[model samples]
Target: MATLRVGRSVARWRVWSTSASVVVTEPDTLAVAREVVDAELSAVDRACSRFRADAELALAERAGRPVTVSPLLAELVGAALAAAERSGGDVDPTLGNDLARLGYDRDIAEVRPDGPAVPPVRRVTSWQDVSLAGRTLTVPPGVRLDLGATAKALTADRCAELVNERLGTGVLVELGGDIATAGPGPAGGWLIHVRDRPADPPATVRVTAGTAMATSSTASRSWRRGGRLLHHVLDPRTGMPSSRVWRSVSVCADRCVIANTHSTAALVRGAGAVTPLARAGVAARLVDNQGQVHVLGGWPS
Candidate 1:
């Protein structure tokens, strides 16, 4: 008898990034796949989201004093600190309080600009200020850990890994537009959409094998505050929203966690970091605020 191959059809389910559709030949049950995606997204929300007060990250943020933490939290903070170093403090994880001081304490949906307020209001700087010894991460007397960049990607990467290990099949995990995939996809590659803004057209990135692609853009996650447009991607060097360098940067690499780290760092560093990224052998595409597209590194021209 021929190999008993269970015929399967494609099914889509929405969760983190609009929706995800997968076609599997081995898995005959649609309900099982949907359940896997649902469970994975729920884990991401519980571990890394800033909106939920009951999230693990929220608990860590409110730890107040030096306290022992789980390996997952430690991994997120460590990756964030490393990114801060790599970006030369351009991607600090200790800027949560600073973001709140600038009127982004709530979701961007509720934000509205008042009028011209201050030109150069400094917020927080230096992830070096957050000290982690063993499992106890000691935040400097008044500092707070924001791991917004790192935690989201970390959750994405982990969720992808979990599905692959448990289900023994291919998986694609996405948070917003950031994505991580494991095993093999339908076409032997994972197809991703890279959008400059919410309204702009999406460009495709074909990823093969175990890979991660992350994009950081200032379009959807920003609002006008004090007569100024402000976004969440804070520059640790200036302690404010990045100004008119690049509108967005999308990176494809081995890990979503590291890809997010680099993409956010590159945005903060502006156009200056393009050469370094190219030299480091990373794929990146940048869209400037003026609508100019810059394809650097391994990104297709």
Candidate 2:
């Protein structure tokens, strides 16, 4: 876990595979925020984690047929399928096997940095292959579903809402740059630093109330296998990491899931993303592989 003092009363935790920054108007409410945040994250991972054997996601995948799921997994899968629909298969949820074959079968920390690149599976699966109705989840044999793209953002949105509603205080949560805020923010709203990668220099934005922001990158969490470089963001069409066009993309929308959907799709769309994002009525900042940054749809001044 990591902490930093922002202004005076902000307390943050860099856990759950990313950073969670929480700030309260009253410093005394800090402990309450932590407890709520931890519970929310734990619930999400336990329900959806691809690596956890007990997770409903794993159980559903291994069933090789339709199976009943918990309410939590159903909602999470619903969100993922919604994302896939919104992005037109650009951000499919059925690429879990592709991710595994690409050497991301476990948590990033546990993945061997020196391992050889995993070749893509010959089987081609689409998000349409998986069906969800009411509380039942069905996946044909050999289909692997992973929600790494939108799950964390959804978690951040829920955490912020829970903390704000429970404590009646302002809450700002940044789960690895999937940011969300609820209730009332501080005097100048919430200050956000948008970066191409975690360590890069930032472009700051101030958000108020219900806005959520997310960044998707082809940079970090990457490893080389057999002389080829690979990172997380996979193109559903290719079943492989997207072609190196943009280094990163960031977007802001009404909710964290929406923000993540746009950001991930923008990265996959590469240079062609600007037009579509503008049409979607969302603000975006994209940095290409050549280090040139492009801004569209009025992404903060």
> What's the TM-score of each model vs. the native?
0.84, 0.94
lDDT of 2 by residue, 85-189 (tens): 998889888988888888888888787776665666555688888899998999879887889898988988999899988988887777887888788877776
Q: lDDT tens digits, residues 111-217, model 1?
A: 45543453555554478878777677766666666777877777667766766766667766666666777766656465555775665545766667677878887
Give the best candidate by TM-score. Answer: 2
- RMSD of model 2, in Å? 2.1
- lDDT leader: 2
lDDT of 2 at 75: 86
Off by over 4 Å in 1: 1-48, 52-63, 112-119, 122-125, 198-201
Find the 10 residues in a row with the least total lDDT in model 2.
1-10
Q: Evaluate model 2: give its lDDT.
A: 0.82
